[model samples]
Target: MLIVILPDDSRREFDDGVSAYDVAAGISGGLARAAIAAEVDGELRDLHAPLVVAEANGTSGKTAGTSPAARSAGAREVNVRVITKKDPEALGIMRHSAAHVMAQAVMRLHQGVGLAFGPTTATGFYYDFQLDKPLSEEDFPAIEAEMAKIVAADERFERMIVPRAKAVEMCRELGQKLKVEHIETGLAGEETLSFYRQGEFLDLCRGKHIPSTGHIGKAFKLLSVAGAYWKGDASRDQLQRLYATAYFDKKELTDYLTQLEEAKRRDHRVLGKQLELFTISQTVGSGLILWLPKGAVIRQTLEDYLKVELRRRGYDAVYTPNIGKIELYQISGHFPYYSDSQFPPIDLSEREGQKPGEGERYLLKPMNCPHHIMIYKSKPRSYRDLPVRLAEFGTVYRFEQSGELNGMTRVRGFCQDDAHIFCTEEQVADEFRGCLEMTQTVLKSLGMNNYRVRLGFRDPNGDKYVGKPEVWDRAEASLKAVCESMNLPDMSVEAGEAAFYGPKADFVVTDCIGREWQLGTVQLDYNLPSKERFGLEYTGADNAPHQPVMIHRAPLGSMERFVGVLIEHFAGAFPLWLAPEQARVLTVSEKSEEYGREVEQKLKEAGFRVTGDYRGSKLGAKIREAQLGLIPYMLVVGEKDAAEGTVTVRDRLEGDIGAMPLAEAMAKLQAEVAAKTVRQVADGGAPPPPIDRGPKNEY
Candidate 1:
């Protein structure tokens, strides 16, 4: 007999080799029916996998206060936790199964199809298939229909583990050359491989799949199709990537589809064009954004707002050139390391006006940190001058692949609200806290209240990092200490997401529509100031040279991307202060045209963005045009109001208000602007007044 340690610390006796499914059946019939997989020693595994122990122990009763590993490591026990349909891991298993079902459906519908890998993504799953022809949206319905048939048949998924050689032979026998090549290149190190078979379809995968196809239900959808190179290599064969998503229930799928439609409606590219806020011209470039007057106002307002806070925080502004010597990046380890993502270096040595070897090569600045590092090393400093804070709205460039570029979110050229601080090791925690506070302040000021903090730590087993393990530990501990002191909520730790230099903190903000965007970040680096690199050092109290710790932070990561998210978040209906045109004066007739001009001039002189519409069109047409343009307020100047020294107010969302004195109207609008009131007009309700608050975010 073998002792099985359940999650609740209860002990159960089972014969050797008893499967997880059998254990679930022993617990309850409902759980056995609902069980999709199980957790074995904290690793997810198929339910059909056998659970066994080396020997039987006489141990009985609950094991209290002991770790799960300690109990499972006993001579005669194995830990088993049955996973039901409600488990989070179950969704990932089902999505992987759905990808297999999709691949099978495509094979059944077409001939001579070669299947590569079909993997699950954060949102859903996609399969890359080497097909005879390209597939489009028109073909999705037929594929989904076939997938439905397969799901209805409820075919059981059979897992077969085989040696590496046999797996290659199986792929060859199935005429899947892509799989054979993958096994040869990507899976060559594995001694054995796992393959799953359902009906006439089989694929090589190490999977924790659902028991059968029927568990997928009818919530699966084939969303789109795009061309992808095999292994993401442009030199490899071009394959068709069928993007898809799935859920356990129809309502969940329906809700997801609704969100997708809403996201489409909120797409910044379409709205950018419709609202005339920004443009991407083919003549200029694909990824470069041309911020129109309206968009410029929004960007400028954000900069001014942050600049005020920065000044209060005692940060000094600095400027850097757009290009620098290639050797600078080489010294910073960004030259060859990130060369693929950077534009080709400018070889000035061959310029017509330059002699041989007179000019060295240059590169477009990929990051602002290296330049700031040089700035920090420019002058001698002592312990008293430590914690030097420098900030800039520095523009950087990257060579993003054309396919990956999407509007302002993923662009080649963009400006970063970048800042760097150099401080002593003892002051690392304090400076980091200030950065965290600043980031949260920015998010809260913009009314982005729904956000979570993520601490990115280095992977213990990974060697991609450049800092010493001890230094990395210190830096990570400092950041954690600050976060704990501040008592940040909804925080999570993600390993292997840290920068090459050091660990970092990221703020992932969720918009009103439930889409999360990464907007702010603070990174702690111990690698850049090392003696092997820039040899940056400041005099300590003992008069010895000591390397200072560097903190890299950007509250607004990218101005263009932040504006893009803001555009979608508010649907282009900006707040009073951020609006390009705060108020537009519309004339009731030609008689009031002169008065409308006066009203526009008065608001403009009072430091408001105001415009006058003295068109010959009717008043209704003018109001409708302003409303479509997303103007916040419309001051109606009719002959009656002009004579009374008043104006009728028309709000974009609240409709019309009674006439008020011109002075009173200006004061009301000014108050709203001064408060930076953010109205959620998308939901058709006015939000509460904006209060001046600090970084207290409520989930």
Candidate 2:
């Protein structure tokens, strides 16, 4: 007999080898009707999978497409529960089934299509296929139509487990070379394999599919098609990858689709060009960004603002060379661990006796930590100088693949608002809190209020870390404590997202139109200052040398990405303080041209980013152009206003506000800028309105 425990803690006895479907049916017909898959002891599996004891310490956490890991050990029994569409795992199961339905549709339409792997992603699912002809948007309608017909047929998906020999034979007979290779190599040590059959379609897949094709409703889409290398290897067979998405109901799908449209409307790449803020040139190179004059102005303004805060917080600004000796990275343990993402090291052996990994080969600085460590080590330190903070607007380079580069958000050469704080071990907590406070303060000052704190830690399953398990545990506990103390509303921990050296607290900010971005971060590193490694030390009150705990922080992760995010967050209409061109003076006629010049000069003398449009063009055209440029304030100087020594001020959002004394107008604008006021403009006007984006994809 098998005993199944319900999620509510009730237990029911079933005959041995009874499937999860039977268990759900025994409980209630409604549950049986809604069951998509089942969870056996926290492991997601097919409804038809027998409820049996899970061997050894193996977890049933594996989902569709991942198949099952070797479960040779059986120290305990497996618990079971049915999974419906309401559960998150059910979407994956549904999407996996949807992938099979898509594959079947494609094969039915095309005569000689070869299938590869189809996996479910966070947003959707995609299948790779070796097609004889090219596919495009025009084919999507036809493909979706075929999928609808398949779903109407109500075909059950039957599972078949076979020995390795039978799996190989099946693949050979089906002419699925990819499946044969996956069975032979991908599952190299497996004693058995699983396959599923639906109607005339058969696939080498371990599926937790819906009972039939009819269960896959119309709330699915074939979004786009892209070329993909088989198994993601550039040297392997290239296949056509069909991207898609699915949802439990049409409304969820509709809402998500709406978000995508809104996202497209505010996409930074589109706004970046429309606003002329930044550019990526093919001639300059793929992952490199060119900050135009206007974009440079915004970057400078941000730097100026952050510099003041950094200074107030007791940070000493410094600069580091763009390139350093490769040995430095080796000592910092960044070389080969991060080597794949770094530009190839420059070999200078023939001339300078430095080649590859052996000698003084140079590498473009991939990180700023190593240089800051060297700066601290250069001078002797005592306990009184406990917290040494060095700051830099440091430029670093990484070799981001061409495909992954997206505008300024993902670029090769970018500057970090990087700072390193070296303090005593006892001060780690306070210094950490200080960093958190500083980060929140800066974001608040910039009006970037919607952000969540995430703790990034090392993955226990993989080994690419620098510190011992205990050290990582301590560092993670420390950072987690800092976050808990903050009592943030949406705080969570993300595994496998840590720095190589230690855990970190990352600020993942969501932007307007609902896209998430990783904007800023603060990390804790005890391993970097170890005596066995960098040998960095400071004298304690005990007169013995001890290592100072290091806090690596970047309030604004990078100038390029921050600016990109800012462009979208405000929809290219920056606030008065951050706007590239704060205000423009327009002349009503040639009579007021002289007054407009005087007005522009006065504002500039008062330290405002003001310009004049003494263009011979029409006054209406001038105002329209300024409005399109997203200029915050427009000052009109005509014969009457000039004679009266007053200015007719027009706001970009509120339209013509009214006339005011020149002094009052200047003071009003200045006060707004000083306060860092976040103006709420209407959604659509000459200039797009600013939006409030909560942290996206957060807890």
Candidate 3:
């Protein structure tokens, strides 16, 4: 007999050889039919895998919950939870299986294709194959058609476990050199390996798969294909990566495809060019963002908003150099640790023709905290000045691979709204709580209320983290306590997600499209102030030197990335306060040109970003131009309105409102701008086509 614990903490006894499927069947027929996988003792397993109970006394036996003595003996209790198709975890399992099916289809279509690795990403699954002939978008239909046939066959996925040596022999027999090499290089320590076979197609995998191919349904689609290096090593053989997505329901797939199209339409790169916000030129660098005049305005507005809040919260703004001595980072433990992602050090010796010891080396600062740390150490403090807050919109650089560059979102050079606080241990909780509140306020101010808080703690098993175990524990506990004391959104504790020096709280915001982006972070560090490092200290009431704890935070983590996400979040239609060009004056004809110019001048005098469209163009053509530019308001001064000394206001989305006096129009726009109100544009409403009125209107 085997004792099983259900999800609800209920206990059940079953035969020793019974499987998870049998347990599901015993519970309900519907559950058994819907069961795709099972999570056993926190590890996902095949639904049909036999249930085994291992005792705590280093013994294996067929036993049930016989007596309290059995529990007292420390026998391991088995926990089994059946995963259905509807469970969120089931999507990844299905996607993984879908990759196998896709691979099988590819192999059947194209002979002798060497398979590398097929893994599931956040959005979909991709399989890398080393093929003589490169796969193109044109071949997607054929590959997908083959996948449909395999799905229709509903072949059961059978698993087999074998010795590692035997697995290598099987790979060799199948002419899968990549698999053989992987088994030798990656899995050399494993004594046994598992393989899954469906029909005549066999592959090596560690799987938690659905019972059969039919479970994949007809909701799978093969997306684009791209070239990838083997194991992401550029020097290795290039492989074709075929991307695809799978869903249990057809409607979900349809919705996902629709979202994809909408995402393309809202792409920051495309909108950035059309709206003339920012640009990336290969001549300057791939990941360096060049802020155009309008983009600079948006960035400046964001900085000013954050600066006001920082000042109200007792933060002192400071400036730091773009480049710092390499030794500075070495002392902070940022160098040699993040060296792979950082630009090469600048050699003063090479330029001065001096020996290595005679000259200094400099690095493009990868982080702002070290600079802030130096500033903290620049002054002596008493316990009365326990918490010192320093803030900066510091620009930093990292040498990200060319492939990873994605406009402003993933740039080599970017500015961070970074701040650091040095406080006593007793004040850590309140300081961290303040940072959390400030971060929440920033996100809320921008209409990003739908977000999750993730507490990133150090992984005990990982060697990447610095500081003592006890120090990390205290830091993590302080963060957790602060979170508990406050009412916040859904929060999760994630291990191995913390920075090298400390534990951090990350705010991940979900956009309107249901996609999540990590936008803000607050980290507590005990290592930076330790004696072995920066040696930051303060004098206590007892006249004794004491170390101060440091808190590093960035509510809007990277201004570039924040703005990039904002562009997509609002679809390039900013609110009145944030709009680069708040309003444009459009004249119906030359008869109203003077009135349009006067309206523009009046708005400009009122401290609004306003422009005049005095070109002799049709009123409709001018409106279309303003709408396309996503200007928040268009003040049309037609012949009648010009004579009446009133302007007809057209909201970007709501269109025209009746003529209002100039004073009234200014007040209305001013109110909206002052309140920083967010207005939604109607769905499926495309901007009117642009008419070539003349050269002046050309973007």
Candidate 4:
């Protein structure tokens, strides 16, 4: 007998070689029915796998010499759970089943459709198919209906392990060219391959599927179809990609669909057009954004505010050219590492008889770090200047795929609020802490309080990184120490995600609607070959030369992406301090026009972004216009208030706050502006005074 510990600190005794399914069955029929998968110790595995005594240090956590009943009573508690013996399967299994069902449905409805690959993604799953004709919305209903039929058949889903040669033969016989290709590449010397079958459909997969097809809940939807290259290589053959989603329960699936709809409504591209903020012209190249006047004002305000904060924190601003000789990047090691993403090199032969390398073969800047490094190496340094920080609002260009191009978030050309610090090993921790503090401050000021930290480290086996093992270890240790010392609320470590040059830490912010965006990043690099190639050195008290550590930090990742996120985060209602037009003065009629202008001039002189509406429109009409514009405050001037040297203030989401003296109103507005107030007042509304109408449609 063997003993198995259940989740609630209970233990059960069973015969030797008893599987997790058998344990679930011993507990209750309902539990066995509800079990989808089993977590054996810390690893996820098939529920049918036998549960043995786990060794002290084995990854599987299994051992022997214990009866089921005795082991159940003596088994230690662990974070493990069992799935249904023969009922619902795991989420991955469900998604994979759904993909098979969808593919089967596609085959039934369309002729000459060959399957490529279908795999579960982070959210759901997608299947690629090579078809003779392109798919459209018209075919979705037929495919869905066929899928429903397949689900209702309740066919048994059996898993079989076959030799790799036999699997290849089966695929070749079925004309599954893509499967053959995958098997040839993914399988090395392994003789066996896993395959799953449900009814007439058989797929090449490594799976732990549900007992039957009917176990798939009625919470599946075929979302859309698009074109994708085979194996994600653009040069390869094109395939039709069908996107879909599935969930264990119907309500959760419905909620996800609703959220997707809401996301479409809040898309920055749509809002940018509706709000007249920016434009992307076909005449101009893709990934290039043309900022309208209002958008330009907002960008300028964000830049100025950040610059002020940077200066206050001891950062010296600097400038770099938009283009530099190709040799600069070659020396910095960016050319070879980032070649695919960079634009083609520019030949300077037009100027004279200059070959590619003879004269400056100027290329557009891809990042500001290389130039900043040059600035650091321009002069010798000592311990006093150990933590020298240089900042720049540099614009960079990259060749982004056309399909990946969206609004400002994924533009080809964008400006980064970039900075680089040259510091010794001893100052790395303090410098990283300072960067974290600055990131927190920036997020708070922007009203982005919900965020988490992600520590990105290098993969030891990957050849992409440039530094030695010891250097990489020290860089990673510095980041980890800073995160721990700061006592961050929530943090996660991810390996094999570092930049080609070094390890990095990212500040990920989730907006109001639960969409996460990487807002800031700080990287530690000790392996830029340029430091050695250029003979960069710092002197110590021992009169010996040593290399300086490089730290690259960007608080606001890029101006374009930051503004795009800010737009959606606040839902277009910017805070008082950041609003392009903070206040607008509305006159009740021609009688108060002079007072309205006077109020606007006074607010403007006091450092407020104020505008006046003096086109002889009604007070209500002017107020409505301002409200639609998302202005934070609207000051009304009328006969009673103007005569008494007072103004009626109307808050944007809060109605009127009665009348106040002109000077007092100015002071209150100034204070709110300085404080960067984002919250509106309570919901006691006020009625706008009546006014005589003038010209129609006049502002």
Q: Which has the higher lDDT value, candidate number 2 or candidate number 4?
A: 2
TM-score of every model?
0.91, 0.89, 0.91, 0.83
Write candidate 3's Cα lDDT for 1-699 as tens digits.
567789999988776677899999999999999999998877788889887735678566444544565567544357889999877789888888899999999999998889888877667788889999989999999999999999999999999989989999999999999899988988878888989999888989888788899889999999999888876678888889898988888877777777777778889999999999999888998899999999999999999999999999999999999999999999999998999999999889967889875689999999999999988888789999878999999999998766567888899999999999999999999999999999998887778887889999999999988899999998999899999888778988999989999999999887777667889999999998899888888999999999999999999999999999999888999888989999999888898888888889899999999998888778788888889899999998888987788999988888898789999999999998877787755232322111111111000
User: What is the Cα-based lDDT of residue 132 in candidate 2?
Assistant: 85
Better of 3 and 4 by lDDT: 3
Candidate 1: segments with Cα more than 4 A from true spot: 52-76, 347-361, 682-699
RMSD of candidate 4 to true structure, Å: 9.0
Measured by lDDT, the strongest candidate is 3
> What value of lDDT does candidate 3 attain over all alpha carbons?
0.87
Runs in model 4 deviating more than 4 A are 1-32, 38-93, 132-142, 154-195, 206-215, 231-239, 347-363, 529-535, 680-699
Output the worst ten-in-a-row residue range by lDDT, candidate 1: 690-699
Q: After superposing candidate 2, which stretches have Cα over 4 Å from the reference?
A: 53-76, 158-173, 177-194, 204-208, 231-236, 352-359, 680-699
Candidate 3, poorest ten consecutive residues by summed lDDT:
690-699
Model 1 Cα RMSD, 1 decimal: 5.7
| lDDT by residue for model 2 (623-698), tens | 9999988899999889999899999999998889999989999999999999989784423222111222211121
Cand. 1 TM to true fold: 0.91
Question: Per-residue error at 597 for model 1, in Å?
Answer: 0.7
Model 3, position 201, has a per-residue lDDT of: 85
Worst 10 residues of 4 by lDDT: 690-699
Report the lDDT of model 1 for residue 260: 74
Tens digits of per-residue lDDT, candidate 1, 1-699, equal 557789998988877678899999999999999999999777787888776423337443234544566567653566889997797788778989999999999999899999977887767788889998789999999999999999999999899989989999999999999989988988778888999999998998888788899989999998999888887687889898898989887877777777777778788999998988899988998799999988898899999999998999999999999999999998888887889999998888776578865778889999999999999999999999989999999999999877677898889999999999999999888899999999988887778887888899999988778868998898898888888899886888989879888999999887767777888999999999999778899999999999999999999899999999988888888888888888999998999988888888889999999988998899999999999989999999999988999999999989998799999999999999887788755531222211111111100
